[model samples]
Target: MSSSSPSLARAPHHDGSVTYLGPVPTRPGGSVRLRVHVPAPGASRVRVRWGQDGEPRLRDLTPTPAFDGQWWTGELPLVNARTSYRFLIEGPDGARHRWLTAEGVSEREVSDRSDFVLDASDAAPDWVADQVAYQIFPDRFARSAAAADRELPDWAVPQAWDEPVVAAGGPVARQLYGGDLDGIAEHLDHLVDLGVTTLYLTPVFEGRSNHRYDAVSFDRVDPVLGGDDAYRRLIDAAHARGLRVLGDLTTNHTGSGHEWFRAAAADPTGVEAGFYLFDDQGYHCWLGHPSLPTLDYRGRELRERMYGRADSVVARWVDAGLDGWRIDVANMTGRQGGVDLTREVARGVREAMTRVNADTWLLAEHFFDASADLVGDGWHGVMDYAGASMPLWWWLAAPGARPHATVPLPIDPLPARDVVATMREVHARYPWAAVTASTVHLDSHDTARFRTLAGGGEHGGVDDGSSDSGLARARHLLGAGLQLTLPGVPALFAGDELGLTATTGEHARTPIPWDARETWDAATLDAYRELVALRREHPALRRGGLRWLSAGVDHLTFVREHPAGRVLVHAVRPRPDGAAPRDGEVRLPAAVLGGDAADAVTLRGEGLVRLDDGDEPVLALPGSVGAHLWLLPGDDLAWT
Candidate 1:
């Protein structure tokens, strides 16, 4: 339970790598080979304690013939739906026993809840981990000429494409810019050139607000966004360019104007009334927002209408060509007061979607700890804001800055060690597949833009191409590098690569400045493009297991290990004196660098120099906010 050092030396390490665990999507009821690396002789013996038919079972691990004396190998029975296991390492003379769970090595007995889990239920689609997703807020992305002809709803306060976005007051949600699907279809080449593999569009259903979380109907796309035909065109265009498209769905609640809500409010005695919680006082709304009415999943009719049936909303969308869905407020879905059908709803939706298309990638939007909900049967993964974004925000945030209004509590900048620890601890709770499939992003439609958080412009302020934006842009690229290289699907908010800045979620919805190329931050855009390309080209960054190497105050080093190859990542921010840090030396096992005969390493990005002509590798870290990814050479076992 105490803090664990991030250093690789003397640490027992295990990840989802093929070297550690074999045959991803571990076979049900089949023996799976597992390995653990104990770099030092701190333990005389090691054993794997796993779950079996409601009881605990132990199996001895023998030392592998290679990697000198660090590697130990064993096989897990995989008898349960979710196989939970941890290592029991005995010190010399069987003293100072240490338990190694997903949380790291603990000297005392620890909770088994943090134990590494291998789900025998189902894995995410094979493509989920490999995708580099780009998220677009529908109304703010772009507006085609065709969009100007469409009539806006009475609730809309239309604005020109170049007008300032109203980031505050009640009018913020009503200021619509009329971006449509056709507009997005026109920009397919931009996304392809940026090297993103998937396009994640925010809700397109008929909604009252510019953000569209408040859907009035699930049956069709908003007419103002060029209707269902435009939607088809966008999907076809994206797919033609080898990109997958995902849609957002709000399952936790519906806009008060939704047809189902209207029907229930009009007739209390009707069958539609059962779809929501209706008491004598009034109906229950999500988080007390009257405009957004929460759904009650206790009744079978609501379930059948949402996702339980072949003709349900969930199935209809997949049939319409959505590669997957990102369920909004999924943590609150089906759990209000005494009724709790969250799990059942997730499983039902997954079943319904897969029936239409087996490869559908389902993701949940959970802002807080989502480990308990990601057991592999329901959502393929979560947005991972709690594990990835929140920690990275603290690490990259400027002094006295907060993430956004939604995250009201103040978060001071975190040291690299604490950030790494937070991320490691939170990720340890998820099944390996869930961890890999989760979205790793800096910001999203519901949060402040990363550039603003890193001290770019005023909170919610638009980009002005000012010199003050340099710090924000550098830190933004630093975080973007981590997002792309981490053990998850990297997602880039639409305008983040273009140096966008915002103080809050509403302000963050500034329209993409496609026409104003001169105002763009070309350097930032190039960094994103290069990073995305690196991730796509290297198997280690796309589908590799992560191993922490070292964590310093201003720098972090890790290695992504894949069977085909290995990559070393070193990320550093500027020192207090604004000089490049020199103490970035991290010694790896000789085997990790291909034992003495390792091939030459290729460096990407700025501020890393190889001084490895001597004994071990020593790196000169970046003088500014920068990152370096080294393509390492190694064989399957010894890396020689």
Candidate 2:
């Protein structure tokens, strides 16, 4: 895994990119062609070791002449629902060989758990790879003039658009900024301008709080957020602007005030009573919170009402023009104590949504490790906080300001190598389709702002003046570049690009300040625009396989390879001690780049200069906070 040697960089790379592996989502009993790059001074013989009929089998792979002798390939039958395989690179001496698996190259045998996977059930919608998503907290995004006429519920404490957010103490959830669906519809132009293809609203169902995770009803939109009619209009307007909208649903529980909970609490013999778990003690609430009642999937009636039937909540929303659903607290949706119905609930949701919209996306919000539930039979993708966000946070966190509350133990700053290692380890656990479909974010509503982690001060609260510092802006933009260029859908929480800051998740919900353009971070916004445009402009960034080129304490480099192109990215982080930055150099292997240094061309970057040393191209890294990208020629790199 060391980047000091070019041989390590060329150590037999393979991934599920269409350019490398295919017949994607192979059917049971079908054969799939698998390929791997074997650097020059080729292996004596290359073979694929796969699990077949509960036994390990090896099949020889010959040099793929179409790839100019640098690539080796063969076929393997996917006889099981989930087939696991790895490459065996045999050296000239029969006694020496290397195992190539998802965990990277190894001289000794590794566990099968690290093997590359192909699942018959894992197929994401083709459109997923091309999306850039924006997350919106509805209450703080924007509000239309119509919101003024609507009556506020008893739980509401209304605030002006320009009023300061109350992050703590009194009525955090009750303080409504009056942002409604019609208001969101009116702001479609801003999304289009931002170059996002999808908009993800946190929960929109009628709830008792401004942050509508506690839903009082699932059948209708909150009347205060302009009702069901406004919801439809927003979806229509979004679709017209070529933007897809995803709704958030809390399948694990509902507000204690929800009609089903209300009905069940009133009558033990009622059909709705079976929908919840009750004992002599009382009904179960999510995380023991009295205001949020948990749903029991053991009851068939609850399943039918939630997602089993055509009239179910899952079906109704997808049918109502939601392009997809972002299941809230998805990691805990179906299990309580010894009972576990997580997969069942996921399958039910997927099936119900598919019945109404075949292309609808089913994404889960799992704050930690979610590999056990990402078998592809259920959610197409997850929020991927564990795989992408957390690692990035550790690498880029400000000194003494690691604010993620989920981690039970304290975490110190991580080196760039550890960051890439964590990402690879987590990403390897799922099928390639799921990996590509997942969302990569820096921060969300559940954690501290990424800006705060990148040295924007203690918190991103509106009153937190650190949000506007030059160093914070530079580091924040660097993190954004990394997010967009990675091999997944890049999602931006609302107001992040505007340089909005908060000390915690609740405080991060600062209004967009639409009327106050002067308050916006114009530089950060412009950087976001440039980064997203770059991602959309290149196929490699959007739909490619990643290969790490180098990793150091302050510099991380990688390449994204696709049939259409190849992009090499080098991200540099500033030193925390404010010392002069060192020059980090990454060498590009000719075997991997498909040619000599003459073929590589610089795209756009800061403080970077390319130096060619014969067959290998060396990238002179920038000491300051910035990201550089280069386009390597792909004409000779194409595979059949």
TM, every model: 0.94, 0.95
**Model 1 per-residue lDDT tens digits across residues 1-640:** 1121334534777876665887744346777888887764545888999988889999999875444346778888887778889999887666788888887888888888879988887788888878999999889898899998898999999998888876678799999888999999998899999999999999999999887888999998999999899999999999999999999999999999999999999998887799888888798998888899999988899999999888899999899899999999999999997888888889999999999999999999998888778875799999989889998988887766677665677767778888999988898889888888889989988888888888888544345445766667777888998999999899999999888888777888989988887878888888889999899888889887888877767778788877667887878765434565544444444443333324536558653355566655544434345788777654645322
Off by over 4 Å in 2: 1-7, 65-69, 93-95, 409-411, 458-468, 606-624
CA lDDT, every model vs. true structure = 0.82, 0.82
Clashing pairs in 2: 459-502, 459-503, 460-501, 460-502, 460-503, 461-501, 461-502, 461-503
Candidate 1, residue 515: how far the Cα is off, in Å: 1.2
Number of residue pairs clashing in candidate 1, backbone atoms closer than 3 angstroms, sequence gap of 3 or more or interchain:
3
In candidate 1, stretches whose alpha carbon ends up further than 4 angstroms from where it belongs are 1-7, 24-28, 91-95, 459-466, 575-600, 606-624, 638-640
For 1-640, candidate 2 gives per-residue lDDT tens digits of: 2134453566788898877887654368888887888776667888999998899999998775533245787888889888889999987566479998886888997888888988888476778899999999999899999999999999999898877776577888888899988988998888899999999999989999988889999999999889889999999999999999999999999998999999998898999998888989998888898899899999998999999999999999899899999999999988999999998899899999988988888899988878788874798889988888888888776766655677544447778888988988887788888888899998888777777766675544332224346667767888898999998899999988887877678877878888877767777888899989999999999988888877878778888988777888888877766664443454444455664445667776854355666555554545556788878766666765
